[model samples]
Target: MEAVVERFLKYIKCDTKSDEETGVTPSTPGQMEFAKKLAEELKNIGMSNVSLDENGYVMAEVPSNTDKNVPVIGFIAHMDTAPDMSGKNVNPKIVENYDGNDIVLNKDQNIVLKVKDFPEIKECVGKTIITTDGTTLLGADDKAGVAEIITAVDYLIKNPSIEHGTVKIAFTPDEEIGCGADHFDVEKFNADFAYTIDGGSVGELECENFNAAGAVVSIKGRNVHPGSAKDKMINSMLIANEFIFMLPDTETPSHTEGYEGFYHITSLKGDVEETKIHYIIRDFDKQKFEERKYIMSAIVQSLNKKYGEDTVSVEIKDQYYNMKEKIQPVKHIVDTAFRAMEECEVVPKVVPIRGGTDGARLSYMGLPTPNLFTGGYNFHGRYEFIPTFAMEKAVDVILKIIELYTKA
Candidate 1:
């Protein structure tokens, strides 16, 4: 447990925030630096076949200790933090024995983790927790997962008497930007199945995620001088607003929950001459997902019809899909994780991921990967936090999963 905490604290300091506009494998240099550090640490922990590829993927193996033919299980996590917030100079603060009250992250900045907003923090009463100092994200989104996996593998190596089959481990980069699996070598990893330790909260066990697509809407407008602008000026910013209003107002992230999906406008930038609007469409059902994309296109077509031909254009790209489609045949993998959590005295919450994970894409790549919990909450923001006990419980669950697989 101490090792897990130490490793998590150490890893967050590397500032590996991913970038989407870089058009590079890692999208950022810090990811490669973190990968190199992890590869070296894997070798130091006596892991075999340690390799850090050019694309910033780190892989290693834990050799089998028993003659029994057990399925090779892989545990994976990402190396980079979300680009939505600052990961640099992440000053984390530890709260010893929380009292279920609001946590003052930065008194100078008036940043408080209010219990009324995030009631989940009450669960950490009488337990130690870690949080950011209100200026940056804590990087616990997947770093906690990374620490748990490495710590579990390290424990297995130290206690060779605990017989187990081959275990594969990997740490990927740019998961935040949706390219975590772009260069992944599933065949090279050579595992029968894998689990991504990247879910939120302590007991979460997920196999379903939103079918996703990204759409970019470009609006071209004619800007004329205000004094001479009768019907000659077409304001692109106003047209962008019209495009936004065309979608269902309630069908948004803030207004939906559970399996219900929504259209999210990630960014908007432009002026009267031209405006570019970036949107992400998500739905659990494939048909509904397609409908969402079609709706966006329909809106663009209608706008172009009213504003003349070629006035509005849209480009849409399909992202990852629901892993439930891939994991249904291998349902036992999720069941094993459930039993492992129960055996570790942790209640299992089989919930659907509101957002996608590296597992979502990996499952489509013939790996049938599911997601496990990392005890994190309020990710990609300043209010993000994780309890120390929950992280230790996650490591225990990981070890128990391996133990159950070996005995099976």
Candidate 2:
């Protein structure tokens, strides 16, 4: 458990923030650097077939010691943290024996993690908690997952007497930007089923995620001098603003939760000459997801009609779909994780993921992968933290899941 904490702290220190604007695999050079370091660590731990691919995915195998044939199961976690916040110089503050009080993260900046705002802190009372400095995000979102998987495999290597089947481990990059599965070679992974250690909170087991799409709204307007402009100048920024106001305000990320769909305007930039607006649409139901995209198209059509022809152009790309459609056919895979959690004394909390994971795309790629918890909370921001005990429990659950498979 201490080893898990040490491994997590060590991994988070590396700056591996993914960039969506990079337009390249791994998205950033830091991801490739981290991937190489992880590959070396895997080889040193005696894991066989250790390889880091060109796209910064690290894959390794823990060979079976038992004579009995057991199903191969893989554990996956992303290497890169979300690009929403800074990942550089993450100074983790460990709260030894949390007292269920507000934790002052940065005294100089007056930044704090108040229990009143995040009441979940009360649940972690008496447990060791890891938080970040006010300046940067704690990369526990999936770094904790990475450490837990490595620590579990390390434990198996040391305790070879514990009979188990072959276990596959993978660390992916650019998951934050939804490209983790884009270049993943599922055929090469050679696992019957896998689990992504990328969920939030303890005891979380998610098989369903929102069907997602990215919308890029491009607006082009003719620029004219104000003195000579009379219906000759069109403000593209104002048109973009009008387009945003057309979407339902009540159906946004802040207003919705638990299967409720939303249209999230991620970014808007430009001026009268040209403006571009970026949005992401999410819905659990496939039909509703399609309708949301259709609504966006209809709005663009109306805008273009009003502003003349070809003024508003939209490019909507489908990012990923609900994994429930893929996982439901193989129900036992989820059951195995549930049983593993219970056996490890962690209560199972089966919930729908409000966001997608690399596992969702993997499931569609013929590997029915579901998501498991990394014990992280308030991910992708400065207030992000994780319970040390929850991380330890996650490692235990991974080992128990492997043990259960061997018995089966």
lDDT of each: 0.96, 0.95
> Which window of 10 residues has the lowest lDDT sum in candidate 1?
292-301
Name the candidate that leads on lDDT: 1
Q: Give the least accurate 10-residue stretch of model 2, judged by summed lDDT.
A: 222-231
Candidate 1 global lDDT = 0.96
Cα lDDT tens digits, model 2, 1-408, are 799999999999999999999899989999999999999999999999999988999999999899998999999999999989999999999999999999999999999999989999899999899999878999998999999999999999999999999999999999999999999999889999999999999999999999999999999988999898897999999999999999998999999999999999989899889999999999999999999999999999999889998999999999999999999999898999999999999999999999989999999999999999999999999899999999999999999999998999
CA displacement after TM-score superposition, residue 272 of candidate 2 (Å) = 1.4
Q: What is candidate 1's lDDT per residue for 1-408, written digit by digit as tens?
A: 799999999999998999999999999999999999999999999999999999999999999999999999999999999999999999999999999999999999999999999999999999999999999999998899999999999999999999999999999999998999999999999999999999999999999999999999999999999899999999999999999999999999999999999999999999999999999899999999999999999998999999988899999999999999999999999999999999999999999999999999999999989999999999999999999998999999999999999999
TM-score to native of every candidate shown: 0.99, 0.99
